[model samples]
Target chain A: MPDKRCTEDEVVAELADGMTIGIGGWGSRRKPMSLVRAVARSSLRDLEVVSYGGPDVGLLCATGKVRRVVYAFCSLDSIALEPHFRRARQDGTVETFELDEGMMLLGLQAAAWRVPFLPTRVGLGSDVLEHQRDRIRTVRSPYDDGEELVAVPALPLDVALVHLHRADAAGNGQYLNVDPYFDDLFCRAAARTFLSVERVCPTEELASNGPLQSMLISRLWVDGVVEAPFGAHFTECVPDYPRDEEFQRAYAAAARDDEAWAAWRARYLDCGGHDAYRDAAGLR
Target chain B: MSGPAASVGPGPATRADHCVVALAECFRGDGEILANPIGTVPMIAGRLARASFEPDLVMTDGEARLVAGPVPVGVEAPDVIVEAWNPYRTMFDVVWSGRRHVVMGASQLDPFGNHNFAFIGDRRRPRAQLLGFRGAPGNTVNHATTYWVPDHSPRVFVPAVDVVCGIGTDRARALGPSGRFFELRAVVTNLGVLDTSGPDGRLRLRAVHPGVAPEDVQAATGFLLPMVDDLEVTRPPSAAERVLLARIDPLGLREREVRTS
Candidate 1:
């Protein structure tokens, strides 16, 4: 069986400065942390990160690698707000393109389907349209004289990084968690996709497992595959492992305190590869 | 179960318990709707509602999985049977279809139920940037929305929300048929429960929590709350309901959020 398996660093090497990157996962769940760590370690600058918003957003913001962020919401889930992201917003360190969650999905969907825009009823009467006037447009519905809807434009990405439960070396991926999230759309919307999975089993093993619905991203959409067990640590990746709560607490706590963050990063993030960090953090 | 401090009576119940019970009551007649409780306290209420009377109500484990039983907050909940995969995208499908009933926090809420969580002050250069209109805008127009305010203060129950995230009664009425399904169901706070059941569709004092005076609620609210001649006290959790609350929240996280003080 032909394998496209490379490394986390090789996945990061495909990315460049000032490119739009989409990250897969709901807030704080199934994030490609190993790849994100790789990006953070590299001196990539001015990257525009598109995510449902999790620690990926927080890490990029803390590292000052992000020039702009296009997101619906950014949080540490249980923590509600990502402290670093919040600090970035308060200080105006990064430009933001905040959309309604639905609109954000539509933007990705539009890109995935090769459409210029997608009509939505989401931000019709809210301040979202007021704030994001440059990006969103309103057009009269073709069916009726006075009916109107918001037109959310496509958010094409230079690269998309995703983490899933299992995949084959061919880049065929499956999500064991309840929701596949927008991982499929993220892959389709991007020019290239790099997937990091917990395990790379035989193709037949994945095929025999069960429901076809669980197989989210097909090999065609993926440009590369890396097997990174515990890739989404500190974030929940169900059926494999829950989030590392103790580590998450430390991360969030460090994010709030400058000196604490410096020391913590020195130990985990600044050490070496994901292995060194995982070892220091005592991750199995 | 071991605590002699815990009791069955409404008087003995803590303020957080009252809030959990009151928040849970919002789903009483909802009948098989998606109960999306956003925050910690609200999650407790949603799960308590499911495990108790509203058994048919669908609930996510708050991360992703739609579980058969209400999993305790912040726990892995291993071996729990997953009913369905209601991910972020599918969640929007439920929202757009007006099937989800959400209980989320509000930075400010007007008398007509216009809520804000976006920002304060001017739109362009906000004095403070809160969570940008995440889903509140779509949520308000699409389905039943109940708000929770842990602390009742004039700043929160504002005369006018600087930014409109959720569709208030005033705005919904102006939209006519398009906003027909919009329902600002209830406003549950630490103080009491409020609703827009009055003739004018302004927030009315539905029920006060035990030991909370009607005047205290009024003083805290920025707008006038139409009071009934005889205000009812929010019902406390039953003995069985308390048992389920304990099971649903083994760590007593709800108590920390609601606060007995």
Candidate 2:
């Protein structure tokens, strides 16, 4: 087995323009902010970002890196709406392929299963079918029942970026939290998967960290494992720390104006690298 | 008929209390099913229902576990008695099985109970971009769904929603057998309780809260709301219900969600 250890820069280096990148985590919880910031800082353009979005979508949209967004909802959980993503949507800055949350799940499942599409009754009569008429299609069941279902197309991604609590040198990842929110599906659905963890422990210690079920991402699915401490900063990583509400508030406040955003971008996102970002963000 | 006995320990029931009771009553006969409630008032209501009358109702710790008892509001990682582990992935299994009853918030709801939390104004360029069509589409179609509107104004109770996230009665009926499980159970707002039991499955005013007039509800609504013949006033929380409400929401978070004035 190969040691899949890499850097955030190396993960970002593999990404190309116009690629569909799936981001793991839901709402404002346990996002790969380090690699997201790296993507934002890089010159990546015309990217189609897929996510159960939080500030990852908002930050990318604010940095003008995203050309399209494939999402169910972009929320800041506690704040209801993500300010930057709201602004982007209101401004029509990025084309959106919004589907039902279940539909998005099915799409990822379809890709993981190597199927063209998965049929479901989630978006049948809703505007989800009407809005994504070109992309999402309906298929009648071939069996005797003959029920019409929405065929959620496979969302095959070029790359997947996820943040787990711990991993090994061989790229086996584990989540210490209660909910492993679609991280494994995102990894399995993508061609390449990069995991950023709080710590890179030995394979023996990794197995002893938590229950067997906590081992979400296996070594076979992962391409790289980057050990970035506080990698999911500002987002809650449970057992480690809660979401920095004050920092998130500041981030939301900055989205009010371009001047405020510019100042914020310079102070946090544009500050050299991950180590500097932690220093600027005052992450302890 | 007179209202229920004056609320015990918590003083007389305020508008928020009435709203919570009304919201809780939505799950009255919902025996032994997942009572997934969004927002502050609905969360309190869900717990209130479970703690008081509907003990069989299943609740979550707002994360993963299917908690045996009702967890209090705003308390992160409290000592909970776990029933089962339900992650986001497993939630869909429950959703698809029609075993869940969700009380969600609505940004805009039409006459036929079509909900829109996706965006306001045009889809091409929205005037206000809210949380996109999240689980609403799936939730409404999958199982019995209800809405809790803190503010009952024309802005929220609209004639036609900009984007239909939750399939309404009209659309659901059109889908034939596919939309079999679709049920717009109830709509509990600050002012009153409504149900889609009117002619042609239109929204009908089921009851009004104490002091609020039927005309007031009609005036606030963008569309004409058909009134039920036996128009009843929404009952205030009973003594036992109030006691449960206090335990479920000790910090008075429900008061902040709705207008007490």
Specify the highest-TM-score model's number.
2
Give candidate 1's total backbone clashes: 0
Model 2: residues >4 Å from true position, as ranges? B1-7
What digit string (tens of lDDT, one per residue) describes model 1 on residues B1-261? Answer: 432223343557788889999999999888888999988899989998988889999988765668888677755678788888777778899999988899989999988888888767665445676776789988988899999999999999988889888878887787665677788889999999988887668888989998999999999988777887688998878888877776777777777777776
Model 2 chain A lDDT-worst window of ten:
A275-284
lDDT value for model 1: 0.85
Pairs in clash, predicted candidate 1: none
Clashes of each: 0, 0
Error of 2 at A125 (Å): 0.9
Per-residue accuracy of model 1 over A186-231 as CA lDDT, tens digit each:
9999999999999988888886765888888889999899888898
What is the DockQ for all candidates, taken in turn? 0.50, 0.83
Tell me, by DockQ, which candidate is best: 2
